[model samples]
Target: MADYDLVIRHGLIVDGTGAPARQGALAVSDGRIVAVGAIDGRGETELDAEGHAVAPGFIDVHTHDDAAVIRDPRVDFKIMQGVTTDVVGNCGAGVAPANDAFRAYYAAGMGPILGESDLPWSTTAEYFAAVEAARPACNVAAYVPHGVLRYNAMGGERRPPGDAELQRMREQLDEGMRAGAIGLSTGLVYAPGAFARTDELVALAKVAASYGGIYGSHIRDESARLLEAVGEAISIGEQAGCGVQISHHKAAGAQYFGMTKQSLPLIAEARARGVDVTIDVYPYVASSSSLAAMFRLGRGAAFETAPAIIASVKYNKERYEGKYVREIAAELDLPIGEAIRKVLQDEENTPSVIMFIMDEADVRRVIADDHAMIGSDGLPSEGKPHPRLYGTMAAVLEKYVREEPLLALEEAVRKMTSLPAGKHRIAGRGILREGWQADLVIFDPATVADVATYAEPRQYSRGIDYVIVNGEVAAEHGRQTGARAGKMLRRGVAT
Candidate 1:
């Protein structure tokens, strides 16, 4: 019998620690990396990884795949991109701990993003059980979404919660944290959660902090009030005594271009003051969200200057799906704002949109920041969802490391792997070290690229040769092998 379950040989090992690459071999046994940098033992299976960069599998720290894992177990869009772990329940959107009211609310408002209306679990623990039963293609970690708590406690009331309501929300959050959520996530721009004040968030965040969890937020505004939003997110973490993760940090709108110049420094200052704050950035300039919500916030003015594409629409598929807002307005022979209002009114505010809002310079600046990590923030809606869903990790390697060369291959791997794993407290899976879980990816550094485009958003990425999850080859040659070797990761719990 072979000494190990698997061995990968003759590859350049990028250990996910921002270390220099070195030619070596790695060995795995019983789902753990048993050896690295010169494996002499024989194995039951061997892969000749010549001309590839073998590193820890990418960890997607920002995703809304709360329902996708159960609805579609393959999750090829993620694993095919060498993402072995997905952190779900981002932007305060999720399907768990649902009552009938929240269920109905989710079916209507969050279906475009989460893609499922039928929520099978009523508690976070039950939800995790369902994830395990689904046997996903990649591991999953989750956050206790603030929106769910708010809706469960207050039924979309546009005011501060009374003392009783506040206690109810805190109780629900505490239940989720005890069930192993990594942190609390808030989408302050969305309803109910949007109604919540900074003090309200700080109260719930304290519950998560007591469990040693972090606080992640899609802040109140990303356009004109971007600075104030960042300050609020930082303040929540400061008061709650927890780390903060700013989701998809960006300055949206034409006037706010290059705003990260100020925002990034503000984050740095907070860190100097002993507040642990880090931010994640998707590489794309366009952002996806509910069309109605955008119009409600008066963000639709961006469509007047730049293009916005309909990502998913519950009705009027032929008229809207994948078409630009300007194009649709021309078809209707109406003004841009009028067209937006008509669409939301017609679709009942259910259509999702991809807005070209942020500047490329701002995106590049954020991606190049040392303290910043990578997140796709890709909304997995049905029609023409953002290409970042299928292509985020590969796109970073292709654009930042190979094309403009703004980052070295080693540094980029660090951002995707150890940096997020450490920050999110995802134990024992982000690095290829002895005794660590053997979740890894092997790709040709020169040819690794994102093939998925806005027009063809479902295409698999290029140059990801092998994706191993828990010592099993989950995907090979840009295709899923149908291996379900994933686990439901819990906070402070070693996998």
Candidate 2:
């Protein structure tokens, strides 16, 4: 007879290795998987997974929950969907290493996302300390924002840094890497970062690579110059010798609908050239961003464009929650872009909206790729918010796997688990094996689906029966059990 912490019996284990499922009883003790095969074991607690699929807990490799994790650390919106870990500080925006010197300029780039409160941390160490103080329900990994790193060296300057300034930027990145940040992230379409030249990015990427970190970018464009933007990312990887992850890999705009056909191959060619490259995409056809950015994307023209459907608007929250920009344009008897600008001017806070700009076929092509991984790009703290914040992982299982059979169950699990863990160099996570940490999710594959929609975005996903973080039960039977066993994971450090 063996005494263990917990054992999940009678489940089909997917294992997160892209292998075939098998019946197994997983035993956990002292925060690690002890045994994961047929066994007669007794534990202090036990769960009957019966007909559920047990796999390593999902990792949201791309997320904007950096500050949200501190404000509402329970992170129920993500945990209910089996997301055991969140990679935060994305889109060239982050909270750490920005003291009073860079706070205002950093706040301007973040817009309404940075409300009235002053940013709380001056360094990555302090940021990690705040996360520890919060006791967030899910584990967290931090990234060093390229723009914030630049801002540390040169405040709000759009021009390329001089030789001395460049060295200062590298120093900040090196500091963040040593402070436990896993990698570097950039938002090329946003200010300052958008001003960066290819050489500048490559130089900064080298600093991150020296510490075994990865590089992820919200590329310069997602529409007309989609392939060109992707090429730039590949170029950075080649010149810097770092693993690259393309964030929210999507082809937006009607004219460039199927451009993924070209973009993916360029990434493949880069891989052929020994430049390690991968991509992450959310499971939906719509994308979300600030109203000001939407207006800029529109170039102040027809809001009635085919794919510019609006999913959420915060100015007149009640009436505009579920309506599209085209509908608002018609209602006001004004041009689509004019309507967007007026709405922004009318609101005191910077408003946010969801755009239905992506093609379903494009999404299918990206998800089907062997090297691509899952990233919700979830913005739980943003206005009204897109359903992706709550439904991304669930929607993938329901729509892509069980419904249309676009991918096999084992392969889908791999994209959500081991693939991301491997790309980010997040050690010992993303797989279910002996000696690995006991981070796992058990859910009914048949019943797993997303209930959150554009109209009502804040809702828990269904079918996930049990969630374990650091070997402790964090959620059970579709609800959190008041456990905050999650820890802040740092790059190059063993868990």
Candidate 3:
């Protein structure tokens, strides 16, 4: 008879605790890690992990995979890259609490980034249940997206919420929190959410705080107004008395190059003043978002100098997919702004883009920050999606740890695992401790690398040898096992 369910032996353990690496064997039993270090017990199944790095499975703390998990339960892009958990409903965008208004919003040009789906629920609890019914390959946690709340309550009204609307939004957030949402997230750069004032945000943050949740934000600006935006996020947290997470922290645009130097300090100073705030960044120089929204936010200026590649378009797939917008404009014989308007109108304002705007130096600087964690921020849409969706975790190990060596192997694992697990309150996972859930990744650190490129963005990653979720092998040797061991995690509750 086997003494344990599984045992992985002789690998270098980087236990996701920021601890020094050590050679050891680990044992699992009934979906929990029963032992770490020397393990003499025999197991029903075993894997020899010699010469590889065995660490906790990566936790993607920021993602927009709310619709992807339900639409395609396999989630191969995340699992193949060794991500065991995905925190969705990021940047205040989600398809949850699917009321009439939310359904209309999804139909009204949100499909390019959020993916098209028939929203089947009217509450966050129902949404979580739907995710569970789909049996995603990785665990999922979520935020009650402020944008959805606004749309549900006010229906795209571009003004401060009236008293009745404010209360309605508050009630929805309360319901989501009771259903185990991790926090309240706002995309202040996007409309409806953008229309809200600071005090309005403070009110909603208070609701999340009451449920012991944090506040995450895609701030009002990431360009010249970055500092002001950062201040507002901090103020909201301080006033609401909750922790804050700043999503995909970067200064985008040529003039704002290297602005993280200033923004990072501002974050540090806020911490000194008793603000509980942290940041997450993707390991890429380019960003992707809805073409119409960026243009409305005055981000189109960057497109004038740096060509923007159309990542997805419903109307003109051959003409726009994977082509630069500037090239499209050249063909049409129109100015850049006019061309963008024409295409947006034709596509029903649903096309997304990959815009090269950030500096590599700034990306390195932000990633090197001890308080900064990693998130893919990848939009899971059709037609040439950003490569980060397929490659973020692997890229961190290959580029940031092995190639340029910005972070030590153990420290980087901490950012991906325990750092996010602790901040987001994902209980009983993210660390390889006895009695913890057995979510893990075994990989050859030397060979681990992201093969997905901007041109070939959908390719799977390389060197992730095995990905285990809750003691079941979900993927092995770059292939999925068709085992869906994932769960929908609730705040402060073990899966």
Q: What are the Cα lDDT values of the candidates?
A: 0.92, 0.84, 0.93
lDDT tens digits by residue: candidate 2, 128-201: 88888989999999899987877877877879999998998888788889888888899898766888999999
Q: TM per model? A: 0.99, 0.95, 0.99
The lowest-lDDT stretch of 10 consecutive residues in candidate 1 is: 112-121
For the record, the alpha-carbon RMSD of candidate 2 to the native fold, in angstroms, is 1.9
The candidate, 2 or 3, that scores higher on lDDT is: 3
Candidate 3 local lDDT, 253-293, one digit each (tens):
98999899999999999999999999999999999998998
Q: Which candidate is the best by lDDT?
A: 3
Enumerate residue pairs that collide in model 2.
303-336
Full candidate order by lDDT, most accurate first: 3, 1, 2
* lDDT (Cα, 0-100) at 431 in candidate 2: 88
| Root-mean-square deviation per candidate | 0.8, 1.9, 0.8
Per candidate, the number of residue pairs that clash is 0, 1, 0
Question: Residue 266 lDDT in model 1?
Answer: 96
User: Per-residue lDDT for 150-267 in model 1, tens only?
Assistant: 8988889999999999998888889889989999999999887899989999999999999999999999999889999999999999999999999999999999998999999999
Error of 1 at 266 (Å): 0.4
